[model samples]
Target: MCTTKRGKIVGYCANELPCCDFTAKNTGSCGTVRVGSSSSPSAVFQSPDYPDFSSGDLNCNFQFDISNVSNKGYDGIQLNFEDAYMEGPGFARHSPCETDMIFIRGFKYWQPPAWCGNLTGYVAVIDKTKNTAFLKVVNILALMSGFRYKWRISVSLIKRSATSKNSETEMENMENELYPSPNINYADIQPQPEVRQSESRSNHRSRFHTKRHAPIFSDNSEDEEMDPIAEPFIVNGEDTNITDVPWQASIRTFYPDSFLKMASKTINNTDKFNQEKEGCSMEGRHFCGASIISNKHVLCAAHCFHGMTKLYGFKRLDHVKVFLGETDLCEDDLVKYGRKSQNYSIDKIIFHYGYDDIILMHDVVILKLKEKIKFNDYIKPIALSKRNKVYYGQQAKSSGWGLTNLTAKGASLPTILQSTGKMFVENKTYCDAFLEKGWAASKSLMASYPKYYNAYESVFCTSSKNDSISKLVGSGDSGGSIIVFDKTHDPPLPVQIGIVSYGLDGLESKREHDNVFVDFFQSVSFYRDWIDLAMSV
Candidate 1:
């Protein structure tokens, strides 16, 4: 229900990817909650659509409303017991993480803290009667640095038992009831692209249903490794099943032309980019980044440039160039395409005001073209989804020339325009079940997590998990945009979701059963007035 430092809400996901280090350090977007681990509050929550949870009785029974998810990372439950006990092997390794774990019958687990840490349990819905599970938090938290917390628990489910009242005992009882299934089955793990690429013709898009599958449950230490993307498993549960490797992302593209052809007007250029290096060409491999909230301004990630900000922060726009029309940036490839390159420069470089100088969230950059673009046949502006949303299953494409793997990771300028389909907003979930996985009522992140929830509130998200194939933004395309074509709109609308800020599986984005996008509309939605103020100024 919260945007983790990684799902965009935890985002996988190497989630909660930010524009720069500084942005990640402080408050992040509302749709994307960045909880720090320093035991400090940073991410804040404010939803006028909901009520103020101030006057509720402390002993009252609080039932949650979880919806729209069909996976572990999507819909489930958690509970955190502060100052709780951990008894078993490797508990220390998972220490600091207050949790609740259960071993299914026949599972040989030597641990018995009955608490939480590196614990694995299979999620189940009893007879679909409740269509939800239970969790509990029995430990009280101490006030540290003026932060005193009660036992906090959360569950991520499509819907909570609306008939039941929320109470401590009911919550605790529910947590205890969720038992691990000893011989968990993986015979039904869903496949990626869940639908075949061949079947996803634009007209047939959405023909692919929102996928559902069981999240893997393994005893290995690696299963819990936090990566934005995940891989499908084919294991024999009856025979010590093990799909417990780190989530490896491998996205394969098919029928990219359908996407390219849809982009009727592209920002083309007159100059040809002569690569000083071999791989950095924009030839059908380079990703496009835009800052065109207005004419004369272009936005991109800082990493797209070869030099780091410490070294190139002061570089002028003339040194930076942009390519629009050319699919192949390599000078040699031009002979085949019979085309030239359109180039622009970085007029000024101003990182996001709160960006981290070293890491992510600081990837945003601005460029200024020498002359105003003549929104002609090839060069034009893509309407930024700066505020509104373009729904699920739409085509979200990333255009750039960059390495798609971990080792060969490289950067490119004006590379080929590559596109992927977009995963839209999944329903808000109840992460209370996640509380059972921890032992504290307090929030977290690298130590300084924000305290914005006093009662139950849901975090909204955009799903983009591609379990069958790893389809994620790759290197050099860091600041590239995630655009989805709206078939429902007038004449097939093209809406923008913000820039492709970051992914979980390093160079290979961790795409799981389904992916989630940090709804840019949520963050910038309220700031429309602010943005207008800035634009007019």
Candidate 2:
């Protein structure tokens, strides 16, 4: 009889199961193995009971630790798969692997592709910064009456030559020199706010605001003609000021006094009351971002308001406010900045008719303010990009008070506004390919957002070649502006081109490398007509 473990037999004991070695005692389960320069430079790992079909279900985990390899002058580690044969397709029908799968993790800088079903002769390289790598083999229904799976992989440390190391260092230094950091203190250089509106400003609501006009481009021009460019944006970002991005707007959702009172009466705990009060305040309520288009209109992501509706019911619009000319959200910081921030109640929010939350198609909203805004040096509206223009390959900038680091514990919203520099726009073709490659490794994303490909057409993608803090954007950055310089104007006008939309989640951001960090934005030019129609109302 075979010994049982975790609803499965512990390998084929004494040929009780077919295709098993009669002489073997226990031929399965290799839990964890530590490998480094101290022991060996290379090691081979195989599925439990190699060359034989193991009895019952299989759940094997193998971890490779090369923590000390870098200290010994090794620059990286390489995984060469000699043989890989597992259950192929047909099980789930939707996913590449359903009944049986192999998951690889623990690489810091590189994202390894999904591994399953005859990946023979495959090679994966991990940077020296990563200390460990994990491989997990899972077979859901590997029974005596079902099919079995097996694989074998060889891992070896890679030692760089002296010349190669020097060349790599020189290349890194050159890249850094090409894109110098902008370490300016934006708050120190902010222009003093004017005491009163000028006569010219009084006559016109805004310098950049245009009259209600018909669509500049016809519907046929909706198909974007893009030229691929190399660049990227945001989780690791720099501090910026409202003077730099005067059009930036903060969309906040606060709890009403009535709801707070009702909550205080319902819950008698003092700690809970204070917590709720603080959390429901204006500072805590900063949700999404927006960009000023006119004195009474701002552009934002529809999902921001959509999510609020789901949380606070249909009356969510009553609790929402738009803050302009603000850098820091803290009360003390606002006072220190001479109270430059202006808060306004929203009169109405118009979401795109084609807005689809599933694929995030037409994820845009036009927020009409109850009153006109008084423009000043610190607060101004930005010009919209022309419908015929596509700024592919040009550098772009994005600003928001979003989370600085996605991996940080709890909500990590920065007090001051964060901006990304040295980022470039990518074409739709490149964006689609990158999305497909990146999403292929994540099974959960594939399962949840199956129609993610539909987003490629209506969105603009941004990325950076060099690994910099500016390559990422976080949770609260939605609806912010992705501005690019339009040289067609005399002085190269700053035009609002894209609206910050969706991107990789926190877990996905961690696995992204330098060039692979990509963020999606809604193309402003694509929906220029819709924006004009909404603004006219």
Candidate 3:
């Protein structure tokens, strides 16, 4: 220790007891690490002895400030943990949250959950909603064993003009202009279900329905009148008012055990050289989309349930959450957006028992929420079509947080719900041709599943009409609604005609005619009886 000129001791100040916990002190220059407004835009932080840290009551805090970059129009910071190995909760090793936990703060309105054990190389955290975040690490009672952890953060500070839609102010202005009030006059747009269809046009093949079974839904009581939608506001994929697609729902999956495994495998196989490579996609908490059919139930594609098996298995209802009246999943400050999001745990997953994952048939599932959803302008259920005929070409709408760009190999998700107009194509021949030739040639799974050899039955087709512009559902759009207008109703109610299923890749040049792509949707008409039965139970 150095001595002062006045003969007094000169040393760093140290707070006592709790303040000066084991890991709290700056041991080996591994104290509170700060990035962003610090010396660099990116940084690497680690425990005192990473890969071999000591034990017993370890605790420290790390902070990040990205306000400077955010003010410059940057999206936010991306934080990734490269390695984490510590003494886990003894008998409670199964609960990583209770061990030598790492706590996070300021990521959003709520406190970030604790993480412990070997979390390195498997964690990627992004702070897009706020400019700052706090991270704390704690280890308890393991002097014999040690701990290890490492982390890195990179910033995304893309510069954009004030007029760009990405601008915060621009988004606020658009939201206010589009929706002057929280609740639209839903009662005024009530549909007249008693209206009769024209006998002449009814005889001609209508482009609205082609299901074997008639429309099926619970009887409407006088107290509950189905609202009408005269015409859907069609546009290019962009953020819109939540009330625009009241039936739309965002599905999030949460399974800590499987998520950790996926993350670790991804990190172990990837390196800095190939980190940004396409197809090496990162999964978000919100994985798929659905559409509300009733206050307690929402409908989605059955295949969506199949894909989810890899994460939480086929029957993990607790791992699923349904978010209604949610337009933007990226929005961190929910209060700023006047969020009316209602999140509910799934009580049951009513999937088609005959659903063939390989053939992709009977691809429909109804999620029953533990609690019923309260109806509002932004949380209404879409009507199921009653017709059974479909015209060759008819206008419809597809909405979800799917891919915004068609050509990109791994497209980023749209921040807000993306809505685009599509046209139904009654071309069983075209669908069969692709399934027999195009799809069969590329996929090996077709050989094992004979039922998938052709698209002859139980499916409907849609495509982007404009050869130059694309507007079809992509990966994350699975289980979303394909709504069509029924003019037969008094006020023209928007009815769900189909649900998003498998589709020809929008990037496939062969499928494009003058640059247009085709997509397949599970006919909701055929699945109406299944839905009604499931909802009834």
TM-score of each: 0.38, 0.49, 0.50
Score residue 447 of candidate 2 by CA lDDT.
34
Which lDDT tens digits does candidate 1 get at residues 164-207? 11322332232223212222233422222322111110100000
Error of 1 at 491 (Å): 0.9
Superposition TM-score, candidate 1 onto the true structure: 0.38
Q: Please provide, for model 2 over 290-344, each residue's C-alpha lDDT reduced to its tens digit, 9 standing for 90 to 100.
A: 8987778888886565421111222245577898888776654356677467889
Candidate 2: stretches off by over 4 Å: 1-234, 257-284, 307-315, 332-334, 435-455, 468-470, 505-515
Alpha-carbon local distance difference test for all models: 0.28, 0.54, 0.49
- Candidate 1 — which residues are off by over 4 angstroms? 1-288, 291-294, 302-314, 332-335, 386-395, 406-415, 422-467, 505-537
Residue 397 in candidate 2 has what lDDT?
Answer: 81
Q: On residues 50-74, what C-alpha lDDT tens digit does candidate 3 reach at each position?
A: 5454443345656555555444544
Which model is ahead, 2 or 3, in terms of lDDT? 2
Higher-ranked by TM-score: 1 or 2:
2
What are the root-mean-square deviations of the candidates from the true structure over C-alphas? Answer: 23.1, 24.4, 22.8
Candidate 3: which pairs clash?
Answer: 82-121, 83-120, 84-120, 206-390, 206-391, 207-390, 207-391, 209-388, 209-389, 302-363
